[model samples]
Each structure stands twice: as structure tokens, then as C-alpha cells.
Target: MAQDDTPSAFRLPDPAVVSRTMADVAERGQRIVQDFLKRQSDNASNGGGTGGAGSDPLNLAGAFMEMTTRLMSNPARLMQAQIGFWQDYMTLWQHTARRMMGKETGAVISEDPKDKRFKDDAWRDNEIFDFIKQSYLLSARYFQTAAASAEGLDEKSAQKVDFYTRQFVDALSPTNFALTNPEVLRRTAETGGENLLKGLSNLLGDLERGKGSLQISMVDRSKFSVGENIAVTPGSVVYQNELMQLVQYNPSTEKVLKRPLLILPPWINKFYILDLRPKNSFIRWAVEQGHTVFVCSWVNPDESLAEKGFDDYMQLGPYAALEAIEKATGEKNINAIGYCLGGTLLAATLAHMAAKRDTRIKSATFFTTMVDFEEAGELSVFIDEEQLQALEDKMNKRGFLEGSEMAGTFNMLRANDLIWSFVVNNYLLGQEPFPFDLLYWNSDSTRMPAKMHSFYLRRMYQQNDLIKPGAVDLLGVKLDLRKIKLPTYILSTREDHIAPWQSTYRATQIYGGPIRFVLAASGHIAGVANPPASGKYSHWVSDTAPPTAEAWLEGATELAGSWWPDWHRWVSALDKAQVPARTPGDGALAVIEPAPGSYVKVMASD
Candidate 1:
């Protein structure tokens, strides 16, 4: 075919459109700056300190300084690494040159197949973009390797250096920038710079919404509401207090499990993660399985609840809910399920109850919980003395740690998935985020009371005291995990960044009970929220609790579906007797509100 003189589709953007877009971006940029400055001024006037000494709250400087010193002491190794990086670049250059000559050449560096950033065809098919991608991958690998190879630093500092290094590398990925990203370029060509303009607008809107911080919209917040769509399980609030509301879901079966089921979700997030929709709602699924479910809907606490400690959470959370469940179900004996931080609290509560000779909890189930924080995983990077002190200073001023702050930390744990993907979509691509129920729930964060969060950080994360017999005291009772002899089901996710399966496995040895450890096949939320009907992920189960997590895994059986059914089987065996289904307000406790209740509906900003 004869080459036509028609301009290539990827030619220079329309000059007029480009000029208008830049002008609009400049105007929005000014607004963003002014808004940020105003927020800073307001915060300062309200006693929130100007970004000063505590700005490096993660103590990144100190960690990197130590790493730098160690690296500098080994000049030969550093030189060798630099030489290796240059060699890799040279090889990549040669590969690109060969490809330019229509010679097939293998990639010098390839990204993981699972990496979504470079999924666009142009990233690989277009030789120039492929070269750019390979160069970035090579550089990223070099930085990561160097960071990981850093010597002489403590384990915590080393981990901090490595984790932040990955963050830095991820941030600098070619895909993150519109100029380097092929898909964004294609979109720009198609839209005459409209995407870029819309992206700037979205960026400005997000900044405004976040009150100066860049809160990338993960989902279209307008698409969903608490009771209307997401957390729409059929239930009623049987009881409530200042800290929590006990939601007793209406049973779907004529005969339900004799022992009622109570779920204590992490107060760091809303309870509705387990009740996001009817299809995946664990509460709804449990109700369908002939078990009366009661969930502790924790209040999105603010300054008023700053004085509330871990003890208060236990009292108003599980303890209060237990009493309410007994009143509502006429059953003193009940099974309890705790998720993440809620599981941590439940473990402590069980120990406290064990100490007090209380046997109300006949069975216990922990979903990705950490009783022993020795190998607390990446989250430990944020719990050093300097960082915790800095965080406490901020919390002391505000009477509570801001929910977004906590949410940001969790987002960092999976920054590529939770943070940067949305950044690319909402800011770079100028596309509105899809209405994802999970992301919506993820965005609906909750605040942490000063005392409770502080105590949790110090005693559990920093000191790893929860496992120590008398290290942590709750309700005047020194917690001892071994004292809790209730039949336990420990469900840990294989890929849990928040609660490492290995870290959670430590509980098997800690608990003095008949322990059944099941490993689910996803991260924190998906693994636990997985319904049997979804058939999305597999699970592993081992009857024996070996001394080590590795040993347990070696002997485990890989099951084909959700661990919910496995959990049901285990929990059901504990108490096989069935009682007539009970309504929420039919017993001693009267209905306070609807299933999700008012507390969950309260936003952190509210």
C-alpha cells in the first residue's frame, strides 16, 4: 500500500486545545494551592501544628540516613552495583536497537505478568514505549535490590528503607506519568486534550474534597448509600451504646443455631465490610445458614470519645454486644467472630474473660487477626518510637487520629492497588472511578480514639505484649492468651498484608484450646468476605497445629472454595442443637434502629 500524506493519529495535540487546557489547569492549580494554604492556616489557627519537626512522622529520614551511612561505608559494592545497572541499561539499549531494525529481541527486563500498569498493548508492541518500560523496570529493580541489600541496619529500619524504596520506585513508574504512559497518550490523541483537562478538574475536586490533601476518589461516592445499596442486610439494631450498636440480623431459616453469632469488625473501619451487599454479605450468608447473626457496629468516634480506651472498646463493643445478644436471643452461650483489629480486641477480651472465669463465649473465630505481633509484617514500618510519638502528638491535639490518616497508612500497604491505580484513573486518565462497593466501603473510613489507638500501638505493635502473659492489662485483668480455652477457629489469609498469615498462625500456639487453622487465598478483606457462592478463591485447612506456620502449611489440605463453609462446619459442630428463629426485638432487647444502624451511617468528616 502506498504511504498517504495524511498526518499520523499520534501527531501534536491541537494547539488551541493545548493552550486552553494549560490555562484551565493553571487556574485550577491556583485554586488547589489557595485551598491548601487556607487549610494550613485553618489547621494552624485550630492548634494543628504547621508542617515542622514531626513532618517526617515515619522517621524516613533517620532510616534512610542509616542506610546511606551503611551503603557509603562499602564503596566497592556501591560501585559494582552502579556498574551492573549501567550494564543492564546498555543491554536494554542494544535490545531496543535490534527491535528498531526489525530484529526480534527478548526483553532485557520484564514486568510481572500480573502488573496492570503496563497492560496496554502499546507498552509492549510500540518499541519506543517498550524500551521506556524496560528502562524503568531495570532502574526499579536496581533501587529495590540496593535497598534490600542494605546492611547493618536493624530489622525494622531495614524494612522501612525497603518498603519506602518500593513506594518511591512505584511512584516513578513510567505508567504514572501521562507523557511516558502510552494509554494516556492515546486517550489524549483521541480527546484533543480533554482527558487531561478533565483530569485536572478531577484533581482539583479531590483536593477540595480532602480539604487540601489529595484524596483520590476510589469510587463514585454519589452512586451508593449506607442502607440504600451497600450495607443493606436485612436486620435491626437490637441494642446500642455510646461506642457501638448491636445489629441482630433477621434469620432466614425456621431453626437457627442454638448459640447466637456475634461479629466484632475492626473499628478502624466500618462494620459493613462484612455486610457490603446481600450476595457477599457474611451476615446475610450466615443468616441463610441458620445462624442468628449480631454485628457490633462501632461508632465513627470523634473528639467526644477520645478518652475511650481499649477497655472501653471491649466493654461497649463485644462485651456490651454479648449482653445484648443474650437479651435478644435468650442464649447466654454464643459464638463470636472478630475480624482484623476487632480480632485483636476479641483475643484480648477472651483472655480477660478467661481470667475472670467467664465462660459466656463457647467458641471463638478470628479472621486475619494478630494476637502475636512478632512478625507483624509491613505495618510495623509505621510503629517505631519516633513515628508513634509523632502520631500521638497529632492525635493528642485532635483528641483522635483522623480516619483518613489511618486509611492512608492501610492504602500504602497496597499502594499500587489502592492508591496509585485510582491516581492514574481519576487524575491522569480523567476518568470517574467506577462504583465499586468494596472501594466505597474502603473509602468510608473511621476515626481512632486517642487512648485506644495509642494503647493498641504501644502494647500490641511496638511491644508485642498481647502474647505476653501479663504485659497487657484490660479492665483491671492482665491478659493471658493461654487462659482462653474456648474452641477456636483461626482463619488467616495467605496474602494478608495487614495481618500476615504467618503472624496470625502464632495464635495457634498461643491459644490453649482446640485450634483449627484455615488459610484463605486472598488479602485481608476479600479472603474473609468471600461468599461460598462466589467461588472466587480457594482455602487451605490443616487439622493439626504444628509448632510453626511453615509446618502447618506443609500438612495442610487445599480446599476448592470459600472458607466460610469450613468455618460454618467448625462452628456448627461446637453446638449442634438448634432453636426456633428469633426476631430482633422479640426478646428482652427492643429495636433501637435499622440493621446497619445510625452509627455506621455517620461519616468521619461528620
Candidate 2:
């Protein structure tokens, strides 16, 4: 069969990502299911699915029957795997805790004992022996409950429910939960004991063989090699923009932007997620539309930068970016666009600059941004006192939060979808994971400075005071978002986990400026980076008065395509013009790479 000359009928370059993804799940799950079923088959090979005879013998038989049924159903072996894992995990946990106390400085390298975010810690500072105690208690409870319930019921029925319910209880035992929890009291509790003796010791007795672990795979690189359009010269809207090396990609266009543009992205992630490959970049589209866009690309922070708190970001990140734009364009105020954490930062900047009486940034646009922190949702589960203390202790020692720690927290929010989903596809399925460009990008992670994180959690999560007037103390300066009197546009996604949609809507009430609110289709990245013609995605109405998102969605109109193009229209009205396109930059960038920049190169990193 001749392959079509046009884009393949698959629509995507690779075979359908979704179908392969589903198959990966089914196939991968088959193994664990197979393993559990084997165990069940042992118990019930000759026995009936139902138990035989009276109380004593019948109870035993029914218990056997339930195990066989669970096995025969071919249910996943994750629980079994998770169970065995916890056993080994508890053993290691105890050993690690004991050895941790022997460290040179005695730092312990542990999480705050009070948080209880990870473990079944009924009290602060979990004791290692609690593992044994809790495990016994759990098993006892299961036995007691089952024995009692089975006493009054028909022998067979009682046995099955009791046996199955016991399995569920055993799965929830203390040893299981504690070991799997990421919030280990101490990092130094790592299982590795470095020495030739330790390695050789394990070699002799333990029956160990390497098994291919299940995990999600990375996406393939772009096959369609298309160069970017980045021509910088005069007769453009960004003409006479100042060129500054302190700032990146500075172009001296000989004129100030009558309509200046500013972009905001979250620090937890790299900036270029929005400025992704040229085909789907929001920044690239804005530049093509004759609007001047200034984007902030924050440098990943290291331990040395831990002392640099939220104030520095306000001053150097958005505030500095705005200043640079103003100096380059010679404009007093520029339009702002923020995505995710950057959106949160922008909202803060609006509040801060307004408090300082600096009104340089006007016409703000938020992409999936949130200002209200009252109901932070399930993600808040990891931020209680115990977890916070443990985090603080660890952060104090390291000075900066590890990227993996932050990534792990977000992963727990959707273990089935984000974490286990990948586990099923890549490692277990035995097939190279389908390479979707988006997942590849999502896998690319970043780091956060310790100080900034603490400030964010305290000011935003614990206080919920930033949205209220005069709450945050950024270098002793109070930030009130309501003071920022610029025209604002807030955007939120329907399926966002990080910044829930309704949280973004709360911005309407917080801001004193006139606002146009948009509800986009898809999750965080899909909603913002969404190009005009990806698939069937929809968004809610663009509202003005009575800024409630609910009331607006009900009364307001629906737009068929992207919030990007419509946003471009709404924003242009703030700084409208019929002028011709301007030069790309100050004619300084001799080699114009693509708009997405180097950050977006989605390689298959294991």
C-alpha cells in the first residue's frame, strides 16, 4: 500500500498514542494479574468457588474460595507487589532509621515528623517498632471483623466476604503504607550500605535476579524538520527596542511599543513549555500577529540561590523583565501574559508593583493562573505541619528543594494517571512507549530554591492572605493584588490539577481592574499550548461584568477554537494598532533558532 503523500491517516506520525497507551496498560497489567492468579489457583484448584459444609471446615473452605476467585478474576498483582515491596521496605526503613542516628553531624536528613503526609504515623516522629505493632494490629482487626461477621451468616458467604475483606485490610497495613510513602522521615535512611563486603554478602545468600521494571516511555523526536521564522529588522512593531545582554534575546527596535507585551511562566517548570516548538508555541503566534511580546525565562535555581527568596523573583523575575521591556521599548507600560506558576507570580507582581506605585505592567493575561489558596485541593494533603516540618528540615540542610521531591509531590496527586499509568506502559508492556511530544515535554523537570518554596507555601497555602489585602511579607513589604488597576484577562483549564480552574476564577474578585475571563479546554499544558487545530477542544464564554466564572459560563458565549486567538483579539484592543510588522529583534541575533528554544528538545531520557 502506498503511504499517503500528505500527513498520515493516523493523523499523528506514530500509530495512535491513545490506542497503544491502552494496550500498554492491558498487557502490562496482565503480568501482575497472572502472578496473583497463580497464588489463587494454588488455593482453589480442586475446591469449589463456594465453600462446603458447616461452620469450622466451611469457614476455612470459604476463605480458600475467595482467594481463588480473586485470583481467577485475573485482577492486577500490584497489591501483591505493593505488599511484598512494603515488607522489604519496612525492613529497610528500620535499618535506615537506626543508621541515620549515627551520621557525623547527626542531621538525620528527615522530613518533619509531624506532617504524616507519607506514613501511617498516628503521632509525631514515627518509631521503627510501630511497623511491627501496626502490622499485627491490622491483621488482628481483619481477623476479628471477619470472624464476627462470619459467625451469624451462611458459612460460605461469610467466609468469602471475610476473607476478601481481610485481603483489603492486609493491603492497608502500617508496613505497607509507611514504606511506600515518599515522605521518609530521613533521606539518609537510604538502603545502600557502601562497601565491598555488603555487596558480596548479599551475593551469597539472597536469591536476586534483575527484572525489567514497568515504566512509561519517552516520546519520539520530531520527524517533520521545519525551520523557524525569526527575521529581525526595521518596519516592525518592535522597532527600536533596546538590546540588553543582562536580559536574554534583547533586540533594539528604534521605537517603544505603544502596545507592549509581557509573558509569565511558572518557576517550577521551564519557561519554554509555552514557547514550545514553533508549530504550537503561543509566543510565536503573538509575534506573528504584529504584537510585541516579552517572555521571561527563569534560570533554574541551585543550592547557592536558596537564600534568594520570593522578593528577589518579584524584583528580578517579573519586575525586572518588565523594567527591561520598558527600557527596551521606551514604553511606560507593557501587556503581561503568565502561564501556571508564572501566572501566579504575575498576579503577585501586579499586587506588588501596584503597592509600590509602579504601574509599568498593564493589560495582564493569566494562563491557568491561581490567586486564591483557600481550597488548594488534594495537593494540600502533602502540606500539613508534619510534612512542612520535614520539608523545612530537609530544605534547611540542602538550601534548595530537589526537583525530584517537587515532582514526586505532584505525581502523588494522580498516581493512577500520572505515576502508575506510566509504570504500566513503559516497563511492563515490553514495547517502547509511544513517543508523544507532549508527555516527553511533561517528563522534563526543573528545580526550586528552598526559600522561594517556603515563602510560597506560607504566604499562599497556609495564609491564603495574598488574595486578601496586605497579607504577604516580601522583604517586609505588604502585597495587595487589588491595588493593581490594570485591565486583566484570566484563563483557566477544565482539567488542571496544579491550579484548579475555579482558583483561577477567583482572580476576578481579587483584581480591581476590568477583566475578561476565559475557560480553556484540556489540562494545564494542553489548554495553554493548544494550537488552533489539534483536535476537538472547546472553551466557555468571555465575560466582562459580574466577574463570576460560573455566572459567566452560564450567560456568556462559547468560542469554537483556541483561547489564544481570541485572547490576541481582546488584548489587542488594550493596545490596538493597524501598523505594519516590526523587526524580529535589534538585528543582533545573527542566527535565529526556532521560537521554542533549546529547552523544548524532547529527548528520550530514562
Candidate 3:
């Protein structure tokens, strides 16, 4: 993993949550509300057709609706979405920490039997442990806020509140403090000086080898960048696109697959994750089973190309990528697979292009993509106007947003796993760190231009209008998911900490299309990297009519093996039959080199 000295932008201010301050503010606001209600009487009659704030039920209902309308319109509230995430994250972590430390669990760290990354130095590092602690502490403060809400009451009420409050604080204090604090540095036996380690004897060996995986800026490859090599199946032939972009090699069989498959990798991470490795890579299994595959490698954003925004991505990213696929393979449309933010972007692109009557994209495969914000989980707490303003203000100064900020925001989302875990393992435990591929890739983050970041936050998480028709405007055009009307495949892990599965499942409700929603086992990364080798890895597939996820869960029997093969089968069913292969571009669009394009090299961090 590339070494990053960058501190988190969402770093909690000193004295993370001020109990007295928050309590006082809550009381002051409450008092004002009380005064208003006390002074105002039920004088105005709603039946009189007066739109004023009357005391009638109808007027009260209208008032509530108005509040909802204003809340939606208010930029501050939208930004507050980000704030709420932290507040909630803190609370959940506090409770979960207690639960985790409690007895009901099997293994804190899941055992990945077939995962090779776990063999070398894959043990828990201080960083991961520290992240756990810090994340819990951060969540504990939110508990305080919630408890403070019911104040100035009797001794029992106060005692109940205080009991919970003190329990959380006490849980976190000396003992709890250790949970949140991830120590990254350690003392070396030889040097006798404090240094960083993670039980990574290999890292130490690599340090001795003098070729450790530290990324260096080369004038040849210098720009904000991050990179990782995922394990693709041995026999899989990964290829590049018209723009010289890296794509998994999906060879054509004499008998074309029943379901044509296309993997949609988020531009944020390298596309090879779909083809990560033989044991886990999804592409390898798909290709072996005679499925046609295409994956997109997003270009790393740079200052030179900061002008590109979400709309530009539609025109160039997935839109252009799909167009290239159709021309190259002579297929009218392909089954598209997307992961994380890429899924969100892919869904939006499909919507925007569909509105324009673009038919090249048929079925969509969304891996952990969400279109609704109503229950956006911990992510919403940070989506308030103030944060957006803070972020936008920063973006306005710079043409593009740094990958660090995006990575930071995401890391904060799972502070325990992403941020503090490394801190504790590396800093506190005095142990050498594990070098898991997914973790290594996770540490490799990419930056977004300010324009794109601001637009995404405002439009998607803030407005949440893209899921509906004519709700979002991309490149001066309206984006509607319904217009696409393509068969959509939405897959989210049951345990995904970043893009919650339930949130991703909402995609079915938003679009009136033939949708297949699958619940996979594992977190965001592990879910997509499903290979036949993972014995425990299973997915729920419902061949019957589309039903509620719960019903699908019940009716959809667990497959004996990996979800990747099942996805390929599902997609192959959607793809057109054998067609002439397209070499590259038609007309004056121009044919470029095979892919692994210039932009695609972008690692998530600089």
C-alpha cells in the first residue's frame, strides 16, 4: 500500500462532543419552541380555506408537509446529512463495540479459507484494532447527544439517562479509549527508537529487501495517482479497450454464452477486482464458463482534466465504454456490472443516456450502488449543506477535488475498519501489518475533481433525485432511471459497511424495470470478488417472479458456490446472441489503442 501522511479531513475537533454545550443548545432551542406554542392559540380555522398556519388538523398536516419540503430544500439540512452520519456512526459503533466485545460472536475476523492474501501477513494489525477503538469512541459521542435530548426530568429519567451515558463513557474511558486509539508506531529492537510496524515480518523483510511497496512519484507516471494489481484467473486473457484501457480478457467461444456478461468496475478502483485472482476473481469464472466479459478501468483524475464532472463521465466513462463494447463485439447491448460508486455512476449514466434514447446499454449490474437517500445509513450524517459548502468552497478553489478527501470520507464511513484498524495495528500493537490484497487496494484511493465531487454529493446523496425520472441533470440534460427500462442486476453484500445492502436494494423500487436483486455474503470488496473457490461464499438467486427481498431471500435458495458464476449466468441470459465483433470506433469517433487508458491508471490516492 502507498504510504499516505494525509490526515483525515473529517477529523473530530478536540473534545469531540461537548455534552454541556449540546445540552444547553438543545434546551435553548426547546425553550423558544415552547414559548411559540404557548403564545400561539388555535384561532385560525383550516376549513375556511386559509393557507395560514391554522390550529386545525388540516393546517397542522400542511405545516408538517411544509417542514418536509423545507427540509428537503434546505442546503444546510442536505449538508447536515454528513453530520448525521457521524452522529449516528458514533452511536452505532458504541453499541456494536459492546456487542462485539460481548460473547455472541464466532470470529471477529472472518476466516477466508480460499483467500491467499490471508496466508502471508494477513493477521490483524494494530491499525485495524486502533480503527475499531477510534470508530467506537466517535460513535459514543452521538449516544451522548441522543441521551441529552431528554433532559431536565425526574431522578429516574435522569438516572436512566446517566446510567446509559456513563456506561458508554466508562466503556470508552480507559478501556474504551484503548478500543478507539490505534497506535501505529512502535519501538524497534535493533534501533531502540520508536518506529512503525504491523507484525508484517514480510514488510520488515521487504524493508531489508529494500524494495518495499512504497509508491514513488515518477516524472513518467507522476500526477495524483494510486494503483493495484488484482488477481485474475490464470487462464483469463485480460485485454485493453480502444483507449488502451485494461479489461478482463473474455474470449469468444464457438457457442456464445446464453447470457452475455460485462463487468462495471467503479472508476474509483482498478477494474481487475472483478478478475482479482483465480480463487476470488469473478471474471475468471465468467470467462471460463464461456461468458463474454468487458470491464471499465476509470482514468485517474488530474489537474489537467479537472473539467470533467459527473455528466462528462456519462458522455465519456460508461457511455463511451459501452459504445466501444458494442462496436468491438458487434453486440447491440451487454450486461453491465458496477461496483461501489461506479455502480451509482453507471446507473446514472444508463438513466441519462436512456433519456436521450441511447439503447446500447441493456441490463445493468449494480454492485453496492444506491439511489435513495431516505435511509442512506451513516453516510447521510455528513451530507449537510455546511459540509457540502465546506467541501464546495474547497473545490471552488481547486479545479478538482483531491482523492485524499474522497478516500478520507469513505474511510470515516468505516473508521473502525479502514482508518483506526491500521492505526492500532501499526501504531499501538507494535506488530507488522497484514498485506491483504483487498486492504492493500483499499489503501489505494483515487481523487475526484472538485466539480465532480461537489456535483455527486449535491445531486446524489443530497438531492437523491436521480432514481426518479427528470430528477437529475447531467451535462445539461435530464437523467431518468425509468427511461432506461433495462433489466437491472443490483447486488449488495449483507455485511457491506460502506454501501449498505438494504440501501442498494432500493434500486428495485426506484426503477420499473426487470430487476434481479441478489444478497451476497461479505463486505463491499469480498462480495464482488466471489469465486468458486470460496466454499462459504453463497448468493440468493430467485428464478421465480420478482418478489420482495425477504421473499426472494426465502424463495431464492442458496447456491452451492460463488455468486460470480451465477451473475454470469443471469447476464448471459440477457445478452444478444452471437454477433460480429467490433474492432473499435465507427465513423469519425476514431479508433484508439486497446484499453488501460491514460485516465484508468489513476490510483485512488496521490
Task: Report the number of the highest-TM-score candidate.
Answer: 1
Q: Global lDDT of each model?
A: 0.89, 0.56, 0.55
Model 3, residue 596: distance off in Å is 4.5
Per-residue CA lDDT of candidate 1, range 479-551, in tens? Answer: 8999989899999999999999999999999888899999999899999899989989999988899899999
Any runs in candidate 2 off by more than 4 Å, and if so which? 1-257, 544-549, 578-606
Q: Candidate 2: RMSD over Cα atoms?
A: 20.8
Q: Residue pairs in steric clash, candidate 1?
A: none
TM-score to true structure, per model: 0.96, 0.59, 0.62
Q: Give the clash count for each candidate.
A: 0, 35, 93
What candidate 1 gets wrong by more than 4 Å, as runs, is 1-32, 45-52
**What tens-digit string does per-residue lDDT give for candidate 2 at 1-606?**
996554212222233544554465456456556655664575466442323231232234445565446444543443454465467556545654664575222222233354232243422234444434444543455344434432235443443455445444444433333233322212113322111122222221111110122222343333222123221211212211211112233224433236667766787865556555657766566666666666655655666677877777777767666655555555667778877777777878777777778777768888887789876655654555545666775677668786555765676555545654333233222223455555554555566778888888877886777887776767567888878788888888888888887777888887888888888888877888888866547778655646565676677676777877788778877766443333444433322333333332222121
